[model samples]
Each structure stands twice: as C-alpha cells, then as structure tokens.
Target: MKLVTRAGWGAAPSRYDLAYIASTHGTKIHYEGAYVPKSLAAPGAHGSCAGHVRDIQASHLANRVENYSDIAYSAMVCPHGTVYEGRGLHRQTGANGDQLLNRAHYAVCAMLGNSGLVVPTDAMLDGLVDAIGWLRNGGGAGKEVLGHRDGYATACPGDPLYAWVQAGAKRPDGTAPQGGTSTPVPSSGGIARYQVVINGLSYGYGAQGPHVAEVGKALVKAGYGKHYQVGPDENWTDADTKNFSDFQRSLGFTGTAPHQDADGVPGPVSLQRLLGHLPGKTVKAYGMLPFPGRSAFVLGKSNPAVVTLDNGLIRKGYARHHAGAKYQPGSLFTTYTRDNVRDFQRATPALAGDADGYPGPLTWQLLLS
Candidate 1:
C-alpha cells in the first residue's frame, strides 16, 4: 500500500498534455503482457521497482507506432505492495483499447508479465486492491473493477490476475470493498477455433513458410539466434533448430528426450512463451484471417490486422472518417481508424451497444465480410 510519486521513480516528462477525465466507469486491471525478469519479484528487490517503472515509461515512449503521450496506465503496482504513479488520478489512460474505452475506465497495471515472474504474490494482490481502492475513492472510478480483456480480445492481465478481478479484487485478508462484482468472462466471438499452430515436424530441415519466419524472428528476439549464419527468413535451416534448442535449454529443458523440449522442434509451451504477445496472423494459416484478438486494434498497436482492418473499413465505405486524399491504409491503429470503426458500429444495428470504437471479433468479421 506504499505509494511512490512519479518524481521518485524518475519518470520522464510526458510528451503530450494528458487529457483529464471527470470520472470513469471503473478501474481496468492490466499486466505487462511480455516477459519480466524473475529478479523483480525477489525479496528485497523493492529498490528496483522504480527502475522497472521507468523502463516501462522508456519502452512506451520509444514505441513510435503507438505514439504514446506517456506510460499508458494511471498507476502501477509492484509485488512488494508499492504503488507507483504513472499518468495518475483523473488522467485518461492509453492502456485501454481506444479513446472511448479509455474514457470508460482508469487503468492499473500490475508489474507482472507472461514469463519469468508470471504469478503474483499475496502482497502484490493486496497492492492491487489498494490501488483500486485509491482510484475509487479519489479518482472517480466506479464500483466496477474489470480486467483488460473484459471487452477486448486479449489475454492481458493474464489468467491469474484476471481471476482476481473477476472475484471482486479481494485483498489477501479476504476482505473487499463494497460494490465489486464477479465480471463474467467476455465471449471471444468464436476466436477459440483458430490458433497459431507451429507444427514441430514442419521445422528443422527443409521447411519453409511465414510460420518458420515467425519462429526464427521469435528465436532472435528471445536471444537464442546466435547460431544463425544467414537468414531467419522463410527457410527453416539448422540455425533455427540450434537457436530453438538454446531457448529450450534456457527453459530448463535438456536432452532431446521424450518431451522433445530440447530437440528444437518448437513445442507448444515454448512457442507460446516465445510469441504469446504477438497477435493476429503472423503466419499464413491456409489463408485464414484469424480474429487476431481485440488487442490488435487498440490505439498504439501496429499489426497486420490493423492493416486488414483499414482495408476492410475502406471496402465497407466506412472510410469517410478515416480515409483522406493522401491517406493510405496502414498498420498503425490511430484515432482515425477508431472513429471509422465507431462509425461502422453505430451504423450496424448488431454493434450499436458494443460500439466503444475498438473492433471486437464480431466487428472484424462483419467489416471484412
């Protein structure tokens, strides 16, 4: 429940003036959605929390595509029960899907990610509760406390944290503030049927495709591409296998045994860890356009799905709001694209209630179809 000011964390000056909100629908919980070092969760590592927050700010600022004015969240909580001020108080958040969605809730990010330090300590959960209470009391946040994926197609805030949100964001002592509800999990709009399957056999010797390229790129990003001699392109060469084996070893998998974890064959668990953050169809899956998850269309995200969305909007004649004389369809999801999606949602009776400017699975399907 300790609070750290932005100055204490050495936050850089925000690039743009943050918009203020008089009130919010509630507080939406979030997590890093990427890898976080295990050291951050260790005891007595509280001193490093500020640096971690600062690093997050640096990353957000460096995201040229998102063009984020500041670190997207209103506040951040560490595992040691310290709350760091981000774009604090009534300021609008960029972490949510779009402007409309941003206006609907304040964002609180738990300093946890998918890999390494995935689980939250009891202290962290208590810190989250304290952060939410602070928002409700002074930030005009409503009674509702929800996860980042409540209305968006994301696995953000991850399952463990989101489960806490759904369970009313209770503290470790089993006490929660009044007016919290168990928010139902949102529908994926049939997104469950599609998956990014990396067939183990398809890799190693002579395999080639966008999927191979994706694995190669992931391997490089994960710091295991040291064996690469030429290309991490479409061709899956010995480099891919060697690099993948290194990644497996890092995960404590050794010897090409019964599990094949170290065989460099790209098992489901290792691949998911390496590329879980990647949304949309990075690999060609028989020409199927997977829903790409709702997070792909959020402001600041630049993904292939955004490009598809832009093209679909234009084809559907929703281009009036986004397309200009010099405008060309691109990957970046900006306010213009959001407004266009909103326009489409308003025009379509099926989407009228769900029009928050962010494209959900149904919106994507309808627009493209």
Candidate 2:
C-alpha cells in the first residue's frame, strides 16, 4: 500500500454543465481490469487522471477515432492520494453492462486493472474511501454503491477492491464502519432500458411505462422534439404512430408491426415500442408538441403559418423540436429561451416590438429576420 501522486491533465471539463449528465439511484465502482505494472508502485511513476487521459488520447489517435470524449469512468483514483476527475461525479456514464443502472448510477473507476498482477496502491484505496464518503454524505449516495460484477457477467473491481469497497468505509455521520447489512443496489425502476442521445444530449427516457405522452416528454427533454400529449385512455393512432414512426425512421430505424389504424389507435407493436421494450435497437421517437391538435396536423390539418412559425423559431434558435414536420407539446422554450428570443428581436430591427418573447407570428418574423 504505497501512495503515489501526480499532476492534473488540464483537459478535463471545468464546468458542471458538460460534466453532470444524469444521476444514479446508486453508485457503481469499477477497475480498469488491465494489468498494472510494478512501476505504478514507484512514487515518481504514479500518474494522475490527467495522465490517464493523455494515454487515452494517444490510444484514440493511434486507433484513428475517439472512443469517448473523456475516459469512460466518472472518477479515476490514482495510485497516489491524488483523485483525478475522469467523468463528472454527477452523471451516469457508459462503463457498465447494466444499461438501466448505468443510466442512473454515477460510476467511479480506479486506474489499475485488477486482472491478476495489477495491485492498487494504498493512496488509490484511500482515495476510493474518500469518494465513497463524499457520495454517501454530500452526494446523497446512501446504500447505492455497487461493484461491476454485482449484476453483470464478469469479475470487475477485483476481489480485493470489491471487498474493500464493501467494508463499511464510513457512515454519513462519520461513524465507524457498520459491516452488518449489505449495501442496497440502486432501483432499476422496473425493466432494463437503453438511452437515446441526440445532438450530444441523452433523452432521459427509461424502460418503464409506454405512455406516448411520457415517451414524448423524454424525447423533448433529451432535446429531440416537443412534448407529446396523446390521451392515455386511447392507444396511439396510426397517424400518431406514423408520425412517431417516421421520426424514428429518420434516425435510421426500421419499421415495426402495425399497432394502429387510420384513427389515433395504438396497436401492440407500437405500444411495445413506445414502452422502450421493443426488440433490438429501435430508433428513438421524437416527442410531439404539447399544443392542441398540433400532433394531429399532418393526420388532419396542415397549418403552414404555425409550421413556418415553428420552423423559423427553430432556425432562429427559439425552440428545440424540429424532428418531424409537425410540432409536439413540449417544444416551447429552453433554459436560455428569453435570451434566444430577445436576441432574435434585438438583432433584427425590421420587426421590432417589445413583445414578451413568446414564440408566435411576430416572434417568428423577428426570428426570420
């Protein structure tokens, strides 16, 4: 158990906006699973998260493509006492096999692999203890930390590291470790699910219920389209299904079994797909706008004014949804909405008006300008 320290790589994102993606119901620990060299025990040879990042960058350059924007792990504890931040401590990353768990779990990875000869240093172990403490006390990670091998196939985090992590490190109250009860695994929220990321943002749609509105809401949240407000009493209509289906197709998805007729009725396959349990990799359906009859436009009426208005606003960066020709419910405003609309009006003088900056005809014209 030797401590090795190193310097920062200076390439990790400094802002939380890019760092935090989503929260985990729990946290999972991982080891690189690669063989660690004895040199890692040497004080001068210990590398920081930044050093690992450099290696990753070099690997990517050699491979001629980027595997990920940063190291796949959220946090990487070095052999020394230094904790190099890998991924942000807040978001779920793609380092685990449990798709649903990965979406909700904040993952932490240690640098050395635990294959056989790889030995984690004392400093790395200490850093792990500190991180677990922070997650439990400050980060709200109560009983929600697990190892990679808990639910997935394969031995991860190694036997020694896993045992060490499970041993009561410290309670939230700074009490001694209570090695009685096993730490609880994070809730999966029911069925396992996959996530869809569009334009670099993941829509938080989990594999839970299949309500069109809910699915649509997730799409909107993921920056895909507007919110969809189809009635829960009735199934999705063919038109509704078609619109969603078409959106998925645009994202390179194939066709599914018919689940609805001409009227807004949902069929089985459509319902299944809506639930996110459809077989294989399905294209993510963009959410619908939350306005009345907006989703029904293509199936019924075509309002060019609203269409152009929506498109213009989207072009001017006022709205988020532009996936389908029609708009969904949640396609209204973004966090920087006021600035986006105000800037559009301010930048163009031809249609100057002290409007509240809502997306309407006047706003649309200003946006066009």
Candidate 3:
C-alpha cells in the first residue's frame, strides 16, 4: 500500500489550529456518507478518492460548520489500494464530535459511499487493513479497531463496512474460504457464496464441490491461491491448505488445531470477510445473519441490528410496505420493519407458513443472504 503525503499531493496551507497528540486509543473507520460512483472513483479519475482529498480539506475550511484545524481524518484510504495522509498520525480530528472523543482515537476514512450504495472493494479494504497495521506498528496507535458509529450515535461508516469491522475486521490476506457457492456465480474475480456444510472432515484435503471452488476463488482474490498453479478447482490439496493457513496467520487466527486453528476451514468470520458479505454468525447460512448479538427483533426496538435486518429485508425484495422511502439504517423497528419481515417470510417456500412479522433467526439468515 503506497501512501500519498499531503505535500506530495499539493495540499493547501493550514487554516485552523493544529494540536499535537500522540498515539490514539485505536482507529475509527469512516465513509464519505454520500453515494460516489465507481466511474468517479476509478483510478486516475479527477474525482477519485485520491483526487478528492484536497476537496475535502477545502470543504472543511469553508463549511464553517466544522472549521476544523485541517482534514477531519488522520488518514484516508482510496479505492485503488492507496493511502493518503490527512492530518498525519499525531493530530486530533473533528470526526468524533467533542475534543475529548477526538483525543480518544485517530480516524481513518475510506473513500466509501453511503450505505446500500456501494460496498468497499477488497482492494480498498486491504488498503485499510494495511493502513491500520501501519498505524499500530509505526504511526503510534493502539490495537482496537472500530467504526465511527462504534463511538458516535450516527452511522458514519454504514452497515457493510461496520459488519466487516464487527467480524474482527480480519485482514483479507489472512485466510481462505472454507468452501461454498450458492449465490449467482460471479465473474472469475468476484466474491461468491457456495453451498457448503461441514459434516465431520471440515471440507479439507479431499473436499470436492462448488464450495471448494468458491474457496479457491476467494483465495486467489486475496492473493493466496498460488497453490492453484493451473486454476481453481474443486479440490483442497496440501498446497491449498498451506496457502490458506498463511491467510489465517494474516488474520491473527493462527493456532495448531482444526476448529481452533486458522486451518483450511474458511470459518464464518474469515470467509465472510473474503466473500465481502456476512453469510452467518458462526456458520454459513444461505442468508443474512443478525447483527452480532441479536437473535430476534420486533417493533419499537431501537438497535443497530434492527437497522441491519430492515436493510437486509429490503435488499431481498421484501420491503414493499416501506413505500417509496425505506427505513433508514440505524432506525428503530416499526411497522415498516415488521411488515417487511412478514413479507420476506411469506416469499420463502420454507418460511411461508411462519411469516410472523418479526426477524427470527431463519428469516434473518435468508434475508441477509
């Protein structure tokens, strides 16, 4: 990951007061909070995240609303796997609200779009992890990795990114897919989920199926499928295991056991990270898993998971009751949520008789998928 210094990018002179605060508690991930098309973000585009860093600074200076000392983030991650320095590692940011909170952690903003608009590409996420690693090792930062919403009440980083963070934010290069593919088959380099179930052997060595092939695809995307000298196949060989293990090591999941070890089994967390979606909480379900700790939810409930479920149902074509404007992320469960759940349940053959207007486990699994 290459970093573009402020000077290297020809940033304007400072306009506000700057504070010198060393290492922060951890890092808070952020997004642009508005839809930014890929066309605008493509590498070398005049509107790419790299090109907009200075525009953001100018906005901060003119938006009197913030009038921040400088750019609001410590660093920014561009879509093309590049890091551009903002206020550097030592300065406080206007990202976290109060000055006290600003001192709590330095912020890193990924040039991401608003929720439901765009998902962070693996390259962008890889750049983010690399940036975080650099902060912890060389830029004077602690170890906790969190989203902007983790501290603030607003959903600054959005669901896809937040869920990525919640899943231990495992680095992409850390592990390989366990094995699965059920979603629409993606192009050679796209992330896909295949049908996979661990009976006893845990999909390793001799596993042969579309799932195994899915794992290989994920591995190659992470730059760890070197074992497949020819191409990704439905076989999990020793070479595949070794390369997969290297990925596990990268995700801080190293050990010496099967379930406990970061072996070839592409556990839920690791695989979800690699596949770019949350398939299940602990296992791969054919749908969206509930927010980290939610089992079920109903009307009047105010929780982030509720927002996630609401959005998941919407994505699955079950949000008809929401009218033109849908329930926003980070919103409380209401008629909109309940109706969406019931509608979703009624659509699935297996769930038709159980449309209870509540996001139960099975419904959540299918909805998220």
What does candidate 2 score on TM?
0.40
Assess every candidate by TM-score: 0.53, 0.40, 0.47
The TM-score measured for candidate 3 stands at 0.47
Candidate 1 vs candidate 3: the lDDT winner is 1
Question: Model 3: how large is the Cα RMSD against the reference?
Answer: 17.2
- CA RMSD of each candidate after superposition: 16.1, 19.3, 17.2
**Candidate 1 lDDT score relative to the true structure:** 0.72
| Tens digit of per-residue lDDT, candidate 3, span 1-369 | 688889976677778667888788888888876434333333444333544676667556656776677788888887777888888767777787778888888888887654112456667777788778777777677878888887688767865677677766655655311122111212122111111232211345566766667777888888987766787787766656666666765655445233223544454434545666532224444234322222224356443345456557656677677645755544466787787778777878878996788654455556787
State the number of backbone clashes in model 3: 15
Please, what are the lDDT tens digits per residue for candidate 1 over residues 224-336?
Answer: 88998875998866667778768866765445431122556554345655776333334322212434444345587454456667777877788766446844577678888
lDDT per model, in order?
0.72, 0.44, 0.61
Worst 10 residues of 3 by lDDT: 176-185
Ranking by TM-score: 1, 3, 2
Top lDDT: which candidate number? 1
Model 2 segments more than 4 A misplaced: 1-7, 12-22, 47-49, 57-67, 115-117, 136-139, 169-369
Candidate 3: deviation at residue 81, Å?
A: 0.9
lDDT of 3 at 366: 66
